[model samples]
Target: MHPIALAILLTPLGLLLRLYAILPQGKPTKRGVRLVSEPCKLGMFLGSGGHTTEALTLLSSLDFARYSPRTYIVSCGDTLSAKKAVALESLKASEILAYSVITIPRARRVHQSLLTTPLTSMQSLATCVYHITLSPLITGVHFADVLLLNGPGTCVIVCIAVYINRFLGLHSPKLVYVESFARVRRLSLSGKILRFFVDRFVVQWPELAAADSKAEYRGWLV
Candidate 1:
């Protein structure tokens, strides 16, 4: 069987493992509660193009002191997002806090042949697993205290990885999913999937929020 097919077939096992980790004996960590009183690590997913712009704009409204040790995740080959993240880091530099940027394989390579999509998707999944598990080992941080994400294909994979991580009792980051301003009428595909798992689901339009009672109307983010 193809590797992608194998991965897909094993997804049910992964879900079962996740459920096992969440059972009464698992002792899952609580969400939204800070593990420590000190400033915590913040992980932000920066997608290319419009997604990057909207994420940076939302960053401007956040209090840096509360979300220090910020780590920006950018898609590989997305130089624009990397450059913007670096610029934001420079502007927010402080002796007491730190900012870093990391790159991961994009879920879909630009202009990739349709026949190669499954392989690329598997590659993306491997990248997500590495960054979620091993990356933290190297960085000395188990996980981000809060993971802020917006609409993007990459965001969906990362959020799933986060959920899996939490299920394994590795970490419990408060996921905040914000729908892009462009999504005024309905949640984007990424937003819709993340809404079911994220701690907070926010929409820029009142109509979108009204349609999904679980989602909060946070006005325009960009």
Candidate 2:
């Protein structure tokens, strides 16, 4: 292979390896600790249906004042989640709270063909790259300090985008994955995949936490 071609191929491979090598193992300690006085820019991915419901339920307990300037990443055409995000802010009724809703292409649609899935998934990833890197500049909101995700296919793409940002030595948020409340004994597919990638993997059930050494059981949030 030509030098430039080899460089291009090896660069990404090296980054991928680095990402895996740096992944949290056993238990994570360095990522979550921070000064309480510092305001955090929160990012959340809301999967439609039950995912959205549980995500909102988890968000309801947060102090809006602390997680100010939140960015709600939602799929295109999912007006309900967007509306609910707005409603959540409205419930706060605090003028200090600020948030933005970013709509990205869904990683996949229901009953989508396996052959076409990769193409659409790539498109979603491209959109994620744009939003993750440029949204802060465009909206004047800093990049997310912590990004929370549940069992959503689209969440994987967001995680990849964050990894890309980190690969480039840019500021990236600590990724946190929360398994759904309904999940008791087994891990959800998304949770299983994201377990190795997120900074924190939280399970609601004690059995799951015991099964996975990396998982933390923090009781049920929803």
Candidate 3:
């Protein structure tokens, strides 16, 4: 290689090597990165019976084992799918179960669960959890509660939960939430406002339109 070209190439490499050497080996990893790369987590879903389907689909399709995740379906729908009912059991015994068929027979509504279940019990079981919410949920008052009661948005809540774990003298845990793709023709001011807050400040692309932010285009799903 030409001397000039060689120097140019070596210069960047030298600087990177120097940086690696200078950064202390004992220097703590960022709380965020540590949590995901080697997580001790409990996955929690925060939606109705519909979310149960999405979570199962995600588990079956995604690289969930990478996170070494475990899940708990917070029954917040009217109908709970705890175990197969007699009809489903009969179908299963006959070897007629559909691959897409789920056997749980109970469903939960979100408000009812939140109002009735013990947050303390859940917190004890999970260090961190993934919360999944659907779009239709934004129309209800529960939407406001999630934004405010949880941690502004899903990502933030998870991140905050990690910090909370730290404060409680526990190791960081991974937090993940599944939100739907955006396709809203008409949005309420509150909905738009919630989206803007998320858009102006988040690591990933905003899933909704925001006047103050440009949306990022993720390539088509293969």
Q: What are the lDDT figures for the candidates, one per model?
A: 0.78, 0.87, 0.33
Instruction: State in Å the error of residue 69, model 3.
Output: 4.5
Q: For model 1, which pairs clash? A: none
Q: lDDT tens digits, residues 67-175, model 3?
A: 3333343332323433322232343343433212211112222354555344533442243232222221343211111111112122233334333333443333333
Kindly indicate the candidate among 1 and 2 with the higher TM-score. 2
Those runs of model 1 whose alpha carbons end farther than 4 Å from true positions after fitting are 1-37, 137-140
Please give the lDDT score for candidate 3. 0.33
Best TM-score goes to which candidate?
2
Model 3 poorest ten-residue lDDT run: 141-150
Flag clash pairs in model 2: none
TM values, all candidates:
0.81, 0.89, 0.35
Q: Rank candidates by TM-score, best first.
A: 2, 1, 3
The residue ranges of model 3 lying beyond 4 angstroms of the native Cα positions read: 1-42, 76-163, 182-222
* Each candidate's clash count: 0, 0, 15
Model 2 — TM-score against the truth?
A: 0.89
Best by lDDT: 2
Local error of candidate 1 at 171, Å? 1.3
